[model samples]
Target: MAHLALYRAWRPQTFQDMVGQQHIVQTLQNAIRENRLSHAYLFSGPRGTGKTTAAKVLAKAVNCERGPSQEPCNECPSCVRITAGTVMDVVEIDAASNRGVEEIRDIRDKVKYAPTEVRRKVYIIDEVHMLTTEAFNALLKTLEEPPAHVMFILATTESHKLPATIISRCQRFEFRRVPLEEQTARLREIAEQEGMNAEDPALAYIARLSDGGMRDAVSLLDQIASFAGGNVTLEQAIDATGGLPSEQFARLATAVRDGDVSAVLQEIDDMMKAGKSADKCLEQLMHYFRDMLLAQLAPDASSSSGRVADPSDLRQLAAGFPREKLFGIIDTLNRYQTEMKYAAHPQTMFEIALIKLCTASGETPSVQEGSAAGASAGGAQAGVSSGEVSKLQARLADMERKLEAALKGGGVAGGSTSGASASGGGRSSGVSQAPSKAPRVRVKLDPFVAAHDSPQSKELTAKWPQVLQRVKEERVTVHAWLVDGEPAAYADGTVLVAFRNTIHRETTERPANKAMIEGVLTSVLGKPAEMVTTMQKDWQEALASGAGASREEAAAGEELRLVPEDGTEPAREPIIEEALRLFGEELVVIKDD
Candidate 1:
């Protein structure tokens, strides 16, 4: 006669009243109709799957006053009292609280008595696994052979913890978690009855978050109902539950697909300002990518049931990027999600993740539609495992250090191999342990033209080798390549030297080395030094060589023109190449061995 919660009020009272689990209900009903019931039953399942509810129904049906019927007459005093938990003959115990040997002993003592007013005495123990080993042993003896008038019902969320002996003596029924569709349908019915306004999308999101538990879905609905004032709105539901909006998630995927960094940053800013949880946003955005990735891979992933985001939006998102970039987005988002928990500033963390996602490059994996679950940080980067890459980089750095030390200690002859050129600190001898071969740097200018032409260039070139000697003096060695103006005529008082590269490049090409050259050059001509840089022919050779190239061979007919330097001939490499190649480009040292 007291008010009950919806879940409790709707608890099944008969086989006909059960919503799902028809198989269990029908089988139990048939057993009762035939009078072939088991003395003990073990019901195992996830919560809200109707385990204990079925047990109560069976008890009431067996004890009906009008008949030993498969249906309980709720109007009878016995049935009503049992349903309301007042019947003395029908006892329900929370095994979780009473899990010691004393409780089992008390139950054993009470099992000897006959039913006071019913055909059979029924005892239901919830969470039977909570019993201690001693308690389990104490009950094991009685359970093997109980009175014909007594029936025992044991229920548990995880049945594996039950002892083998206890499990062996009872009839076990393993209940599966209800599917999402079924749970959503059930929530809809309840919402309609309660007169609470709800959206299908909101209900579907709740059902998924419940993870196959109807009880969890109902609990979510209860929470949502309280927050929304009986009218569940999509925004309210997502905010309360920290879920992602379909539009926001869709935008995230689209930005990633397009590799649009600015757009990604804007989205991140908007979400952070909106007070959306950074970790939750990362999680849901990752989910959105997973869906897009699936659609991109599977030629025909047309349906949208299992997806958390909109499938229609995914088509445009997938079109924005090559089908192969999906995995990178997933990886970036997953990494951000994991790092968000420990981040001092979650906004910064998510923004960095967005940056990585927009810039990441690699193959896109082929994942089945609706199967992109559990894409954690370590799991997401299939092609480039960040852990492995970090480990490998660390190992390589260590190996390089060790190799340098070993070479410096001297080769097989005990002669140090670690130095020579002030510019290259390491010895020119190639390192034996490099994971990849060092690339060759080639400057192809015939020997004839390199010796003449720019006498000023020649004078500067002669000053260059002392860099190695200076290194012997433990000095800094800077190598600068003139990519701009040519050495021009060293006429009059200035002794002009010109370069074709920009000031920044000319500044860096070899400030230290250039200073050393300047010292030597001034020593040669005896005047204030004047070397200039210009970004002209930018030499085809220097441009082609990538980083830096030495100036060489300035013969008028040599024809190796490099940029807008002061020369009509091909730009040749400096005399430093032979020394670099012969001694080893990395380092050179004079040792005792």
Candidate 2:
């Protein structure tokens, strides 16, 4: 006897043997028993959901020598021939390969002929959605009104791709993905029948990997059984599926909750080194957090299953994270997962995503509990009442408000006498005291401030690194000149670059240097923006005046450090901006596949 694949050997032989699609089976059985067979039938669902199996059974039942029966008696010659694919009356076509108009026209011509040996002729076309428009047109009339001696069964995973006219003419039965319990039960039955030594957990794990596909589950089992010599363990199942053990997932959760970026990256690196897919690693982690969420909401109802070995570990992990934080973590992973499809380096994306999650702010209840306990004990020991705490908080808030008012009023937080006097209101507008050797520079501070506050300016600020890189690539001299300055204000496609000295400012304002920077801005931002140069002192003077600060104080305070002069680097893209773009003003984060 030739060796047969497990999925083929254990293919469902009858409707009674079909699992997790009782509704479709019952309806089909009733139709068969009542002799109410439709000329054309359409079966649609995900792969490995028994569409083809049902089609074969229907062919056998109608052609069974015993009679048109609810169940095919494989003992009869007609059923045996159909089962063995030797029956001329039954034709199976792979629509993916034979999807041209000529093939469908041939079927139309053949439907007029009588069955050679069976009671009726049957044609099964799989993946019918692959059929071309001309082929579908050719199939339409015959599908609508097939000959009395013929039956057509069309199966497709994507039913929405089928034409409305063809779908309307056929009786449609939607097959469903097998439920988890049912899939587990079926695998257990198959394991017993094959005499394979497997624990229930091992089979269940295989079922999970199958992802609701019975054929896939069986295939995975066959491969693992071959390797393990019929004695399958839970570890073997996990290894075969390329899934990390529950302990690793728990460790990963702990690392993330503790904000241990290095540990998280190490665990992910270890998994990738072990040959597990980066995508699956992220998927499993997402599910782990999802389980934590379930544990928090329904502690008693939560099942550890494939997520964790110890249910208490799940509960402990869940307790360490707030509901909102877990939601954010899941959402972040989901966005990266979507991007992974188009990304050239998916592993890099995965690592970056987890690193972000580690830094996200959300204190566990335990951390909050400690703080609260300390506050209460200290307050009680000092004989302070809640009323006093409220008063102190109000007083502190008032001080903060006044400080912000002072800062906005252009009072330097701390500065020398001369800077304070320069910033004081006595300084004339558009003119600052300068040494006899240096002359004051004139600039339109109002236009520069307005432009800097524009939304486009903020966008440019966020993507400034990319813009700088583009500039470096276009012309190094322009980048060199621009490096000394930082964008102070952007408005109406004009950027004000503030420099520490007049020399650099004058150098950047040259026609050639200015044009190069603007060209790069246009390439990066999709629009040309004028680059305006301003001396750092002049820019600060404008800022103080606009902030209602006395010219003396604005000039008196230490120089503003908003733009680093000595080649300071930009920080990682702001988390708040990224979060806003992802979730859009919602407190909750929803993960999408």
Among these predicted structures, which one has the highest lDDT? 2
RMSD of 1: 21.8
What is residue 243's positional error in candidate 2, in angstroms? 1.1
lDDT by residue for model 2 over 1-593, one digit each (tens)? Answer: 01239889899988899999999999988998888989999999988889999999999999999978999998999999999999988999999999999999999988899998999999999999999999999999998788899999999999999999999999999998888688888888988999999988788777777767777888888988887889999998788667878889888888888889989899988988998888878888887787787778777762324343334458887898889888998899887777666555678888988888886642333344345433443344344567644433333333334335556877422222331222221111111122232223244456555444567768888777887787776555667777888878665445677898667777776655666686777688886555556788878877767744443443333333222234442232222223234324322121100
Worst 10 residues of 2 by lDDT: 425-434
**Model 1 lDDT vs. the true structure?**
0.63
lDDT digits (tens) for residues 1-593 of candidate 1: 01235567556678776555777887888888899999999999888777888888888889988767878988787788889888888988889999999999998999999999888999999999999999999999888999999999999998999988999999998877777777778889889988999999788888777766666677788788887899997778787776667887777766765668888899888887787878877777777777777766763754434457546557666766665467656766775676576556777888888777766531122122112321232133346455544433343343334445666776422222222221122222222223122221222223212332456546655554553344223222223343233443332222233345456444533435454454544555565543323233433333345323233323333332112233233222221232234335444232111
Q: Please give the RMSD of candidate 2 to the true structure.
A: 14.3
> In model 2, how many backbone clashes occur?
21
Cα-lDDT of candidate 2: 0.73
Clashes of each: 42, 21
The TM-score obtained by model 1 is 0.56
